[model samples]
Target: MNFRNPVRRALVAALGALTVLGASSLHAQEIKERNLRFAFSLAKEHPLGVGAQKFADAVAQKSGGKMKVTLFPNAVLGSDPQNLSAVRGGTLDFTSMATGLVASIDKRFMVFDLPFLFNDAKEAYAIADGPVGKGLLDDLSAHGVIGLGIWDLGFRNMTNSKRPITKAEDLQGLKIRVIASPIFIDLFTTLGANPVPMTFGEVYGALESKAIDGQDNPVAVIESAKFAEVQKYLSLTRHVYTGMPFMMSKKTWDSMSDAERNVIRAAAEEAKQEERKVTAAKEGQSVETLKKSMQVNEVSPAEVARLREKVQPVTDKFSKEVGDATFQQVSAELARLRTASK
Candidate 1:
């Protein structure tokens, strides 16, 4: 062999081997270790809490131990409004919160809580997973947050110590504790009831002391918080289809690689599906549990129709307040979903 040729061949072989080894190591490093902390307002037994756990599990699994999620439930970190501020400030990485608090940031989010806007959970999911929902998420980018997907908090029902609410008139004069959302206040006020806007942590005490005569929440939430003990009547108003947004800090999200972002998005979508299934099952069971402890009243279709008619103007008012264009878009998308589902 020519000595120069041998030397050149040996150098080429070593360089090729090093290149291969470097690529392999880079591939391995692509799946680097990261820990994401998430906070929520509900306790571990609630559906939101359950969904958060599922999300954390899925992220860890899909990322192959590269990404880990730690959950802070029961408002361990703080209330919904507080955590939302924290996330925006970059002090917190991620959170799932009631859209009512989010509505304060962008009034368009109130569309989700508009009374009777969604006929059912499927309809709600369709709208949230479609263009209107994506637009709403894009809108959040300006507020220092990014909305990943909607997590089911289930449909809201009414509970009161005064009496069972059968129709719009029945709600009159009842001091109903509501989340600090303008839509809720407008809806309840329109129906002739006193809407007392307050924090979630304060609701139980308010109800117990008769500081507020009643409050609205999903069946699972009422049961989980033992509201049945303070509340004498449970009315299946299903007034609003409630859901939470899985949101992340804009700073944290921008720092993530495209691959990492994809993993988190897929995990959130998966968790949303799981949450819907569990919430549907839990609602009925929670009702049964509440029936044993308090009087459970099912409002007939006729009564629900009456209530809907009474609240229609409230929706119109909200549309005007939120801007007519955004409301029309939301309504049109929701209509398309309903027609398709039917």
Candidate 2:
């Protein structure tokens, strides 16, 4: 502690600084220069597109331009389900897809597809980003994909070229285009509609050709895909809360060094929040925009009650399918989150 020992003090400080700089240099060297691809079904101007850009920017910053991610929007790499398959087979790098689309690979993902499970985005996030969500993500390792994080896809409402759907019975006899998940098929079928399993790429044409009478998606999707041009009614059923998981292929993830992985994880985490905000902000505007082109109807609370009651059987069936313990725990978590948020 003697200041008079200038030579010794200067040596010590220099050594300490060198040690820190060396560590930083090593970390920086750990990131290998690589370009990557991220695909999603939403249009580039959509929130998912914004999120992908945010993630790509963060990766660039973290890797010092050594890593780059190109965005593929509007199912150019194929539909969500197809891209998911490619990711699993190690042919694709990353994609953000609805949990229901992922549920086709593992039924557990469908647990989020339960109708009326969450009352709002806040409650949904509380359940999804917490332990229940972690477990769901963790289980993906066995399926050859790395589950990065889940973002909000907002609540799904029904849109159709047919009459407006204000009650569960209105869903009856309508051939609705649904994601290629069993739960969607069952959900629509139980409510009396014939569910036609189709990918996002086929929806607009299907609606245009009258191959399907209606489809369900968040308002953002409806607007981005220009569904209003082909469909007449936009029913605010808010039947299912959708979850989007940013995922990477296990092959791509396994090849990355720990430093690279850390940077990507941090970037994804940062981008996730911004993506949710973008999606939420666009939702209101999207709805208003659609109203200008289509007959938009808000399902009455009494009718929503009826829809939930009708879908209870579908819920019970999926609970058993996804395992009673998981279903019960998720329900319990949502209850806790709802009460706490209140």
Candidate 3:
């Protein structure tokens, strides 16, 4: 019937041609061949490493193989500091490090590193994925990095070659390695332990040689890094919750088309959820694995309360350093979450 009508046939042909042109235009705007390097200071089997690979796979699939994200784990690219500099300079495309290390780039991030700031991952996630966290992340545009989203690293515990830390006083006189950040240094100092600001890569050697008596990190890190071989004690202090801030070089981000950015942002969000799930599941297993080789002990709630009291000064000091407004904002948010839960 259409073949019998030239006008009807022409209308159908025009519509089909327009559809093809539109698709071609959309593809040209959104897809491009790209190779990106993502580096971090953890083994491939670590939760963060697992998340990075998930992100890479999602990116490749989302872009239909137009974009490739290469992962460099275990500090193969460089230490966290070196990688941070490279990312800022645009030589590296992405990296994630402890929020404490990120504090060096912007001290405001120190708010997250405050001792005993978070009781668990649920509270931490609320602070990170909520308004205050997004605001702090948005502020990173000035530092030449695009803050994607915070991935969970879980609560940090203490390990040492010395006796178990049953109370705050037990930590006294221990040479504990800490992230190269002021709050950590002050926190350990206030607790009477000699704080050694060190990079994650140097920690194993330092502990093995007895240069440092102890170090605190999430169980996943301690297990993945095999600290159990050299450290004799594992104290489940859960004193601080560490969040991995996944970021992109602003230069790389600015160069992307809207479509490319969308793919990246979505991939990061999905990978973040996956990372948190894996991290939570692995923590208990890591502790169980560690118990086989280390004298693991749980710090009682009463002692933990005393530990929190001892570090109050350090928290107060950093509350001013990170800016009263930023500090107060987080405190208010935490209060609300706690109240609602009760």
Candidate 4:
């Protein structure tokens, strides 16, 4: 009546304070602690591992050590294809793989593998951070995968036991190991190399045994995999700009609260930046390190042009499969980036 009872006023004040505290608190009971597993086929020292470790550390720190990610690098969990399948089936939480490998799951991903698609890392990042890249990631949800974002895989180069690649014709008759993908097979064959598709996990042993003549990969990968130990040459072919995408299982995603999901997404983005830095830092040193043990050569611009011309048919076939409109959209964006730089 006259004045509200002190007990009633005190109760309201206490409730208001509690509401403020709860709103600001990150540790909501709705977020259950989990031991999540993340898998990749690359070595622990590789950029993929560096970024994955960064993600795991960020998640643990942000979650107040409630949720922790255990990384299974070097295909301990399974090969890229197998890990992808496990994530889709809810047996695994997440995995990172080349978009080229994921193209097997959906041909749209092959667009990233198109030869000479990106002239440099800046152009690639612009496309990936822009609508074109995000649109591709967004496309994964329909297939039970959620792409956190794309990370740099760096430009790919060729390494082999054969002579240094001075020209496109140097690839002729060489038995090259390639990712078990249509574009890789078609690309190598068009350049006159015998393509042998194989899982990355098997590459080292195959090369060591001389079962395969050579393989192509990024500079960091060539050094990290110690291919220099068995392979005699590294050709700076820089044939493709590969992007590594972090994919999550929709089932695993559905199990997390909005808070946990936000932490994960942010952590992935941060890790992406970290991975690219590591790759860039190691790029020059990787070549130097490989040269100490293996013959390293840079293909001439003329040779690269010939190689590009040879792979055009493979890109053309996939252009239709990737849908002409999507390809045109990205191509237009790439042109804009180059024009602006000019």
| Each prediction's TM-score versus the true structure | 0.90, 0.96, 0.95, 0.94
Off by over 4 Å in 1: 1-24
Off by over 4 Å in 3: 1-21
Error (Å) of candidate 4 at residue 115 is 0.8
On the 0 to 100 scale, the lDDT of residue 70 in model 4 is 97
Q: Ten-residue segment with the worst summed lDDT in candidate 2?
A: 333-342
lDDT of 4: 0.89
- Candidate 1 lDDT at 205 equals 88
Models sorted by lDDT, best on top: 3, 2, 4, 1
Residue-by-residue lDDT tens digits, candidate 3, 1-115 = 5566999899888999999999977976677899999999999899999999999999999888899999999999899999999999999999999988888878888888899
Candidate of highest TM-score: 2
Give the per-residue lDDT of model 4 (tens digit) for 1-342: 323898888888899999988976745665668999999999989988999999999989887788899999999978999999999898999899988898887787788899988888988888788897898898888888999998888999998897999898888899999998898898899999999999999999999999999999999998899899999988998999889989999999988899889889988899999999998888998889888999888988988898888888988998888888789988999888888888
Q: Residues 1-342, candidate 2, lDDT per residue (tens digit)?
A: 675798989988999999999998999889998989998999988888889999999999989999999999999989888899999989889999999888877788788898888888887787678887888888898999998899888999999988999888888899999888888899999999999998898999999999899999999989989999999999998999999989999999999999999989999999999999998899999999999999999999999998899889988888899888788888888777667766
Q: Name model 2 segments beyond 4 Å from true.
A: 1-5
Which model scores highest in lDDT? 3
Please give the distance, in angstroms, between residue 84's alpha carbon in candidate 2 and its true position after superposition.
Answer: 1.1
> Which scores better on lDDT, 1 or 3?
3
Compose the digit string of candidate 1's lDDT tens values, residues 194-255. Answer: 99998887888898899999999999999988899899999998989887988999998888
